[model samples]
Target: MTSCSPTLEPPSPSRIPAHHVPIIPPPPLPPGPQDLAFSPPLGSLQAPIPPPPPLPPSPPAMGTAPPHVFGLEKSQLLKEALEKAGPVPKGREDVKRLLKLRKDRFRSDLCWILFCADLPSLIQEGPQCGLVALWMAGTLLSPPSGIPLERLVQVATERGYTAQGEMFSVADMGRLAQETLDCQTELLCGGLGGPNRDLVLQHLVTGHPLLIPYDEDFNHEPCQRKGHKAHWAVSAGVLLGVQSVPSLGYTEDPELPGLFHPVPGIPCQPPLLPEEGSPGAVYLLSKQGKSWHYQLWDYNQVRDSNLQLTDFSPSRATDGRAYVVPAGGVQAGLCGQALLLRPRVSSH
Candidate 1:
């Protein structure tokens, strides 16, 4: 059996042994300062040896310079930063925010309405009474008693009087007066640049009233006799007092001369009187091309000797119906003719 079986050595161990590699250490350098003296001087070398002095600092290489030190431009960097900051909001909300910021910083709400001496007095007296008086008479009336200068403004706003409504606030009144003065200034300087400019300015500055005459009597009181006459006239006068007169620019139209006709810088139309028996007639004064018309009433006549003037109320004659009064009404004293108009002053 031993002979037949070939000598088969046991199978060698399956795994090979790992080898350990040796690591060689680096050689040590000679001593520095202490060994320097032991070495031969550089001049004693075979070739003419040069002495080694101190080494200069290393210069910066061209491409190796630091980013900031290379003087890199900032435009690209700034663009990148702005891109990261993102987009901004726009339109109404942005505008509102900006307005609020400005208002808070400036304290604009605390600003007082600016007024000249004349304008302040006028505003203090209330628009219906004071401004109306000024427009009619070129001055304040009777020193403006019984009216709180401040209350007038409060009442005006309460009555729905507003600049937007064409009814002015105290501030608006001041602005208008200032504007009037400015216009006068332009006139004085002949800024209009026409031959008649000076003349026109002169008339305005002189306070010449614009007037137009009408043949019809809008006032009906002439038919009434005695004590009864003043009653209707007074009511009519009171109504006229509170009514708003149209601006010259609005009422001046040549097409409807019966209603509106421009006569130079000013125009006046005669007041029409209602017939004695007429049941409160209604007359319309309309400017051509305009949708609006003014309503005037002729009610009962009331008389005060002070009321005789065209500026007084009850308008010369009355027939218990409303009729249009010419612009600015009749002047205060024309040929001993009274204004015949009386304005009613009351809180709305």
Candidate 2:
């Protein structure tokens, strides 16, 4: 009674077309027997994709730089550091020649040693500034006695440098020198100051190589330079002005015609610098007799080096007057803190 059947409205012209709208349904597989006899069904247990040949056992974690076969590449690096300082020092051409001639031998020396691409990006792993320096010095001073860096890492882990796989604490390194490197080592510079003049010479005189830390600020360090991202280099030589150093002369009798007498019981003293050039900047040597001054290496050469000869020593008194002299030519002064590393025959 309420209403007749409601009229249905026809669809609008926009609603539907004469052609049917199709859906993208996947196609069905062809039937069984043919598939089994012909090519196996796409669903059959195909060779399990072989898991990509096990991915070559994966590489040692990320921060690692590829292992380099032996060689200092020092000559090339030194040339780069010095040529930037100023007119290359007197015999740089010779050093370059040595580098070229000894290049093969140097590589042989660094060959088989493991090195990681240490960078600031790896800050979480700990600063590599000290590590790189040690790497160079240990290789140089110890001569044929260094473990691959990866192995060093493992040994450090066993020795309790367990904070991060690639990180070694100062103590960790000291022990590493003892346990793994089989040599004695000491931290020469800590915090923002350079080491004492005579101390560096003493070590060099005794055949110890120094590890110098550098940074852009050249202020607080152990890591970070503009391009350096915390850098280090091996201090291999001391540019002493004179060959032999004499001890102080003291006289019990002022009336004696001659200069003061020598003490009887003194052991030979390692030459302490004259007040003249108190702490002469160390004359860095990568190779002997090449006259490389204050040579340093940077793994990341991120910024141009600022190596002007900054006098580390101002000179001590020959008698009374201080004897200060230019330490080295245009020192790259990559040093913020310095460390002394000496290799003694391992009791082990």
Candidate 3:
């Protein structure tokens, strides 16, 4: 052991180990990183941007309030849309976009405030749904030139369009529209058990509302056997080609703007849908007995309602001319019958 300690001396330079260097870490990044910037990592939690403030309590449900609730005079584009068949504005931004670009894409719910009368007053005395529908259609097409509902009902009675205050025959209604409203009427036969999809889209986009007949009772669930009571209504707006993911028998029909709540007596369903390429929802200005308002029905609801009216006959019309009793008169129901009404163009 003594001998080994004595021999411990400075050996060769290669044998000696290298000197250790003290390592120092880099300085921290600046508070804001002035020179370099980076966005937050993907899928990171971020402060949410707030949503829009809610609208005023739904504007008293369509038919509940006075005529001023429709607010037609507030927007000139709305006036032009209903009166001149001008391009409809989808939303607030769409209004500006249409005004500036003048290019339209039909991808939203179209609405026209064509009917703003007191419903209770109009249909209180009798079964005048057909006349009310015609009145709405005439007003939509003719603007300030449309005749009064009373006058229209009187004329329909005198002309035999209605019997015992009810209108049942689709053909007779078409004739009535032509003669009374001075409308160029085109009757579309739903040969395929529903409304003609092409015809519905074509007329609706051109500001021509359809006078359609459907069983009012069939709209709600718990199907009843009240033998179809054909109720007439006017389609004020139509949402066609609703964008939906073509999956296994499902749809995602976008809702119309505004807080549309369900009324007590109206039929409220989970937005009944049709096939992908079929007719979409229809917003009908309908009057059923005491309840008069806008009803939302999918294409199938309208079709089913139309189909249910197969056994419906006029309440009082005995003559063949008063009902759907033509030469080969067998198909009696107003199955998918729609009247395309256009104002008679004056040839000055």
Please say which candidate is ahead in lDDT: 2 or 3: 3
Stretches > 4 Å off in candidate 3:
1-121, 143-145, 191-195, 218-227, 244-289, 313-333
TM-scores of the models, in the order given:
0.16, 0.37, 0.49
Local distance difference test, per candidate? 0.24, 0.35, 0.46
Q: Return the candidate ranking by lDDT, descending.
A: 3, 2, 1
What would the per-residue lDDT of candidate 2 be over residues 227-313, giving only the tens digit for each residue? 223334455543332333354432222432211222445444444443433332223343211222323232222112322213332
What are the per-residue Cα lDDT tens digits for candidate 3 across 1-348? 000011112222233333332222112222432233355667989754454444333323433322211223454553443334322222222222322352233224432111112222122234566776676577656656466665655555566455544666667677777666666777666532333655554455445767777656644321222334556667655443333322332322234342132233444332233343444333333333332334444555565666555554445344444442333222452554567777788999
What is residue 221's positional error in candidate 3, in angstroms? 8.9
lDDT of 3 at 36: 35
Give the number of colliding residue pairs in candidate 2. Answer: 42
lDDT of 1 by residue, 32-115 (tens): 332122455677855543455544545444322211100113245433433343222221122234334543322222211100
Error of 3 at 336 (Å): 3.1
- Model 2 residue 92 CA deviation (Å) reads 8.4
